[model samples]
Target: MGIKKEIEIRCHPLMSWDISNPILSLKSRTKEDLKLLSELSKQNNWEVDFAKELAMSYQTLVLTDLQQTILWVNAGFQTMTGYTADYALGKKPTFLQGEKTSEKVKSRIREKLSKGRRVSETITNYKKNGLAYDCLITIIPLLDSNQVITHYLALEREAA
Candidate 1:
């Protein structure tokens, strides 16, 4: 019998140089922008509204459970990942994590998430192009009644 062949797919990587965070580029207090994100998160159509206001050119990722189900994504997500909303929705954000990701860093994230607190850390992520980029990830634990973590919200920016 002939040998069978198998195929695998992967997330593509983004290639560029020296791009600062858009919030940092505004030349004003980024604290305000950061604060606004908190306020907007309470809104119903937060994903669409915030992406339009912030001019996000990449996907805005949100996880609705510790298992990392994608809860919300904006148009930028489609543009960056070359995947439509239907394909990306409900998928795990770890789709971005790969062989290049550091186990130590991932361990740290797991530790923090398990504690039910906001965690900020930078780690490597492979984009849809299979190119590597350093993503500054800020993960927030969303709490429900009685302060139980109902979800995790993640924001990412390219490293300076």
Candidate 2:
């Protein structure tokens, strides 16, 4: 089989992405993006050849720097949280926390972060409308080639 045939056989329907007009170009992507792309490609059977676009297409993806400053948020995040990327950028994830949010959960998350560990917590998060809802947040650490933590990929979903 040829290279084209190999790709055709390996590519899953969900992995199909238009490379013609990618959201973020491969050349312009940051080191973190490259690292994430490589990681995602290796872990999943799906062809993540267009990892940049796949990341953008994620329903609840929120990329943040090591300092926890928002770097990029996907459209799904905007629709779910009611905050545009422009408004969310450079802000901490704590911005979503409100009076109804759990203090114990916040402290646990902080502690886990200080230890540079992945955290999965279900807590109350308020939307822009001030309506509180339970959200399952999973923060994954993005590491560089040398294993230095560079960024975080926070996946959020409404808890049933």
Candidate 3:
């Protein structure tokens, strides 16, 4: 499919942004999703290009602030986790963890993230429906132009 070039101006309390025009024809995205992407790009001085690419390649995308508070999630996240963006927002990713989750793996991930490293792990994660599934997660520390870690981008998919 070809790319769709559309100009949309969305206003938020902090700022107003005109999305970079041509949005990829990967999937159906809501206006809030587009606005979140725009805000993330503007706030971090990063391009939304990578997000678009990742959206197509990954089943789920989770964006979290430095404190690990969830900032945004792509539509695939809801499909995969059975949790809406409204419910997931402001919550840490740990909320997905349950008794079946491994403490050792969690510790290792924490160690890597604390040092600003990228981590990949396959761990058991609980869905909103109380079912556990093996999930492969890749967490990358997002850096600003100043070379400081500002946020994290986690790409997740069910482990086969």
| Leading candidate by TM-score | 3
Which stretches of model 1 miss by more than 4 angstroms? 1-59, 79-83
**Consecutive 10-residue window with the lowest summed lDDT within model 2:** 7-16
**How close is every model to the real structure, measured as TM-score?**
0.60, 0.65, 0.73
- Candidate numbers sorted by lDDT from highest down: 3, 2, 1
- Give the Cα error of residue 155 in candidate 1, in Å: 0.9
Error of 2 at 54 (Å): 8.8
- For the record, the alpha-carbon RMSD of candidate 3 to the native fold, in angstroms, is 9.0
lDDT of 3 by residue, 45-132 (tens): 6533564545534567788888898876776676689897778877999999999999999999999999988899988999999999
Tens digits of lDDT, candidate 2, 1-160: 4322332232222112424533553233333344544544354322323454435323466777778887666445655777766777779988999988989999998899778788988989888888888988877776655566767777777776
Each candidate: how many clashes? 10, 0, 0
Task: Give the deviation of candidate 2 from the true structure as CA RMSD.
Answer: 11.5
**Total clashes, candidate 1?**
10
Residue 82, model 2: lDDT of 76
In candidate 1 the C-alpha lDDT for residue 60 amounts to 46
Tens digits of per-residue lDDT for model 1, 1-160? 1100100021222223213444443322233333444454553223323434344322344434567776554333444455554565567877877898999999999898887766788888777778777877777676644566656667666676
- Cα RMSD of all models vs. native, in order, equals 11.4, 11.5, 9.0
